[model samples]
Target: MHNPRSDKPVLVGVESLDNVQQLVRTAGDLADLGAGTVRVVTVAVKRSDSPFRVFSDETIVREFADSSHELLDRATTPEGVTIERDVLVARSAARGLLAAVEETDPAALVVGWRPQEQRTDAVFGTTVDALVERAPCDLYVERVGHEANGVDSILLPVAGGPHVETAARAAIAIAARNDARVLVFSVETSGDAAALAAEGREALAGVDGPEVPVETTVRESDDVTGAIVDEAAAHDVVVMGATRKGSLRRKLVGSVPRRVVDQTDRTVILARSGDVVGGPLHELGRLLRRW
Candidate 1:
């Protein structure tokens, strides 16, 4: 099925000018595919209400707004994509981004991630961690990598889930923009590998978007994560669905997408569809994590 949010704008939350090109480019491609606009946003922390301050809160906000505009100016937006810029003030970046989602109601929220030493205690960094649970729209987390002159191939690993369609659509959009090819890949631990491959092909067939060269591959591997990481070495970008497991399980065991992001040097875009299935129990788990 086609993404229901395709007609809405894409909201991108950028932390800094560094490594923001990929984030903006990805957002632009998605927006371009949907014939929508891209809203690039940054958050400025509101100054504390202390009695003593050298600069007024208004002055601080003005400075931040200027810097934000400069950062937005430096972004390399995709061709044929409409772009908008904004600066939001909130106590925290996560809160500011969540607020933007509420106000703008974008089709999806795109953010950038820089690889760091994996923390056993965290799923993603602070801002992303908050959005994973609370954001009302689809989420795209791009793991920034070394600059690439162009994109010629996209690796899309699918295992059949709510987010598969979203991932496929993103991969197809990016491929259309760059004249690249997409490989719909799957790893079967047991059962029939042929059936798994067929399933992957079907998933790609269901996505509606600009036509692009597409291929499907299925392999038998006991190590799903390793298989994906190895295949990613040959591709410029990897687009895959976020784990369907509950948040608590992901926190403890780590998801395949998370592992692939950590192990691969290639840029990875993890897509999570907004049709969250976990009911009240899932919400309770998220709340407990906050405490």
Candidate 2:
């Protein structure tokens, strides 16, 4: 499942100072997994012409680029990994990031996320959500905090779906570089626990995390999200797949990943399988709901 030819750059979308360290760590992880260049990108709001305009747009853009470079320079780059800095100005952060993705065509887009009390504006609830829906390549959203420090132990939540297989590949790629342990966690609400556990193990057996040890467990729980949150508390990172089911409205309001980001302290990476699905109206409604 690992692409030997995927030597493309890994683009990281960094927002604030709070997430810079986390984003840097993520870019390093990706670089270890055969990705060549690590591009760190930040977006600034595009100012429109107005009577109150004080500074020229060119000056503002230069200042923003300079600030972004300064902040990214604080990050430590891994060996063999080239760090590239990008400053994008658009109507919003999400639009700016999407434009970058289009230009770069990266192997994956790494973004940082933190729980917000309220986000009343934006199309995808937040920039991360919007990028998830629109990004051309695979997406990895890292939840930033004290819990997202290291990659010693990694968790891969699987459900025996196509996305699960994709997620397993992602886990193997990431674990290979860090020598991290892979814990294949699954929840059994209706089926046999033993069967689910077996299936989880089989899904990960082909991709053995590049010599990294992998363990599988299937627990019975009515609240899947709650179970994931509890398990994540014990692990450093939880790598899961992009959600396929659920209404656009629900995805906008609150999806499994969103819930996990809000409730869990551990870092998360939502892996996509490059499959095109529909739900633009759902996204549009959610964006409109904020107004």
Candidate 3:
């Protein structure tokens, strides 16, 4: 049920068999983040008609080899990491991952975010959207760095409020794991922006802001959308909040996350809310939805 080698910070990779290739690649990439042990806990959905056997035959990943058990074995074998495979014959991707995480209880849950325009983007739809709002542990909503094999500084566009805390906390762990830095930025339109940003930083005081030095910035601007997009373009990864339609004025009006993801080449890690604080990703999402 757990890796006995070392606590060495865990990164839980979640996905259906459709993402086996990506999962294997991500597991290898994360291994380089630290000498610490890495485990790739993956789930293959086993429906009545589409049993686990179907996935076994189609897996292309040499490291993972498509077999859930084999993937976990190989990961822990050559290294200290452990892989736990599951055949969750479930109705949804999120549900399958939720089951795996509950069973595994990894340190930090990592999930890839493929662009929506691609042909295989069905995997990035409401399923992931809901999961982003609800997964266990701090969810790493990744996109670009997976292809590059590593991430640079995490460009977290902060609003200088408690709302950005969840995203900042998640970014801290991810940055530490990836040997990355955190660029905490807040775009100012007017009205004592520095003072306002100080207030926001105060909210983050109690959050788990790992050793990775977080560089906070308060930039003056008139346009919120353009400033955010501009801020997103500078970093290798963009971390922000996905405000609800009823409460998130910026997101509801301009769909800030959708826009940032669209206009920037960097990967977007959209944390839905910080209200739930440091818990599983799903708990935060579920808590926010009630608000």
Candidate 4:
């Protein structure tokens, strides 16, 4: 629990009870990786002034104290891993989280999203949708039901974008930490596996830690969603871009993200423009704030 910031402590913001468990589970995976330690930060942003509110800045600080103590008491939290966690109160939770990213300077931020109960919210959760638009650090938006600890295998589909490399960097860092190999696939009519592998190797070239094995695959079909859905089942997580193309069309033609969320048991990560170092990932950024 030393706190000058180890290799890269994860900054996680959770809003739901479900997210709390998800964050805890993911934190364990991050700790196991030795990429650094995983710290949990649960945040609540309020729209109305209600005393029922527990996320006030001071209140959060106090609650974080209790939560951390309770968290430590449990056998689930690894004994040796460092835990520097907090509860934050902010006018806008997402903005506060991004600010924390700047202030705490974690390598990246992990966010949990359980698709909205209704059809529209399924498109995106309001708060999660906002963080994608504004978060400063790399973001990994995870869906529920991810009970696994290590991301032994991953699928990062290079759906063309300015922030594509951002996703690659995030994936590389993750793979390096977990001692996992990444299968980089881009849904395309034609793409060179050798070339894609080279790109993945290049993207991960300078990151800290041991080398991460990389594989490249290109799937063909008019259906982007089908390709992603099929491959994701075999992997632990899927990091893919969400295009701004008509939702109905993508859904009908196949939205890789929508289907992945709908069909898989694995965690699905949505990376936006600011996260990736390059611009390809920025392609999905366009969808972040749109209606």
Candidate 5:
């Protein structure tokens, strides 16, 4: 199915001018995915001497905003994409982006994902973790350094869930833009390789439009993450769906996508198709409905 939100505006959080190239490239990819406009946002704090200070660092902030737009004009805004610039002066990057999201409810919020020393507590970086938990819209965390190579070869892994269609739709849109191919990989299940292959093909067929070439593979592996990581090395990017609703499944088998993020060298996109739920409270609703 085509993404319902693809034609909506996209909100991108610009970390800095250094990341302008990649950020713009991602915005273009979103355009191919059906985004009508890209709103580039940045955050800066104003310096103030005291409550009596009438002229806060308004000049400095204005200069920053001007420079930001210049950078976007030079490198970020592509030929056919409508671009909007926004600067928010907030305490932190997360707060600034959240403010922008509140003001302009974009279809998806795109942010950079930098690899950092693994903290024992958080699987993703601080900003991403915070946004994933609370963002009002779908979130796309683009891993830096793995710039898409014309979307030449895209990797999408699916076992069985809601995210399968979501990820497939994204891959199809991206591939359609670059005239690329999509490889859909799935771990062996049901102890039947042929059956798995058949199922995988059917799933791919359901999502695969005439826009791009798509292929499917099913392999047996106890280490699901290892298999995906190994396959990801040869692909331009890996798009995986978030399984936020299945806590029981996560507790039992762990999160394959989280592990894949840590091990893969290629760009990883954690695509969420809908609004984030209110954690345990959301789960409670599901339980109550079962009664």
Candidate 6:
């Protein structure tokens, strides 16, 4: 079932100006869908006090806030979408972003993923890893692709999961903004392919948003990740839900989504429903694993 469109602003967390246009654009579109604003936020790490330091903490924060505003100024926000900018000071990027989520109470939190080459050890990255388990709002982790010049077409792969509805809504919101078409594709290895196809169609049908053309397709493939990766080549963007896994396993993007993000160059948006929050012990375990 589709939930009502949230009127809360969409919050986008950025580390730098690099590739932030796509993120801001996506968040702007999502905000436009709900008649809300887009708040672009960047975190400034608070450095420890040193007697020999050249600049004071206040000076450092001022410089960082200036850079943050410059970054926001560079972002090409969608027309008719209100945009706000902020620079948060915290011990780490993850802490700053989590604090922003708590203060803003946004409907969705948008973040970017570094390419595999840039990050080899963590699943997504340090900040994203922490937010994946703790963010209190829906999460959209974008892996921007060079080929995704425009949102002319969207590839949305669905399987029954808590996040399918959110993914569908996101796809539709983007499609509506770009006047693009959505292809709701599903892969089934066995047992009632037609049923799964029907469910895919229903997922799109239930989304409440601007009218956009949507098509559903089901293909039988022994390799779900390979199928998604191959089909993703035909579209400009791929929007899919996190895998259906328990909370601990959910700390990382499901294996399929992780592989798809790794394999495909198409701009991928991995959506996760925010209904589940990991407890303190689980959070501690994840931190230890990362260390």
Q: How close is every model to the real structure, measured as TM-score?
A: 0.86, 0.80, 0.63, 0.72, 0.78, 0.87
Q: Order the numbered candidates by lDDT, best leading.
A: 6, 1, 2, 5, 4, 3
C-alpha lDDT (0 to 100) for residue 223 of candidate 3: 73
Q: Tell me the deviation in Å of residue 42 in model 1.
A: 0.4
Shift in Å, residue 203, candidate 4: 1.9
lDDT of each: 0.77, 0.69, 0.54, 0.61, 0.67, 0.80
Q: Tell me the tens digit of each residue's lDDT in model 5 across 1-291.
A: 333445677788887666667766666666545665888887764335433234345654676676865666655554577777787776567767877876887777888877777555554666666676556676777777777655688888876554556566657656766778888787765676456445444555565344577787787888878888988988997988775533533421227777887787777887755444446775575467447
Q: Which stretches of candidate 6 lie over 4 Å from their true place?
A: 47-59, 118-121, 145-147, 246-252, 278-291
Which candidate should be chosen as best, given lDDT against the real structure?
6
Better of 3 and 5 by lDDT: 5
Candidate 2, residues 166-245: lDDT per residue as tens digits?
56666776677777888988788878656755665665666533567888778889998898889988887888875655
Worst 10 residues of 3 by lDDT: 1-10
Which residue pairs come into collision in candidate 3? 72-83, 76-81, 133-285, 134-282, 135-282, 137-280
Candidate 1 residue 133 C-alpha distance from true site, Å: 1.2
Q: Which 10 consecutive residues of model 2 have the lowest summed lDDT?
A: 245-254
Candidate 3 Cα errors over 4 Å, as ranges: 1-13, 16-39, 48-87, 105-107, 118-124, 144-152, 160-163, 177-180, 190-196, 199-210, 244-254, 272-291
In candidate 6 the C-alpha lDDT for residue 282 amounts to 54
Q: With candidate 4 superimposed using the best TM-score fit, by how many Å does residue 240's alpha carbon deviate from the native?
A: 2.4
Which regions of candidate 5 fall more than 4 Å away from where they truly are?
Answer: 5-7, 45-61, 118-120, 189-210, 244-254, 278-291
Per-residue accuracy of model 6 over 1-291 as CA lDDT, tens digit each: 666778799999987677678898889888877766999887777646643156655776677766665676788777888888877777678988988998988989999987767645567877898888778788999986453787789998887667787788789889998999999888887776667656666777777778899887788899999999999999999999888754554443687898898888888999887875556765786587568
Tens digits of per-residue lDDT for model 4 on 94-163? 7668667757776567777776556774356656666665566556677765645667887887655444
- Candidate numbers sorted by TM-score from highest down: 6, 1, 2, 5, 4, 3
Candidate 1 lDDT over 121-201, as tens digits, reads 557777787787677778888876654568999999877667777777788778988999999888887776567566656
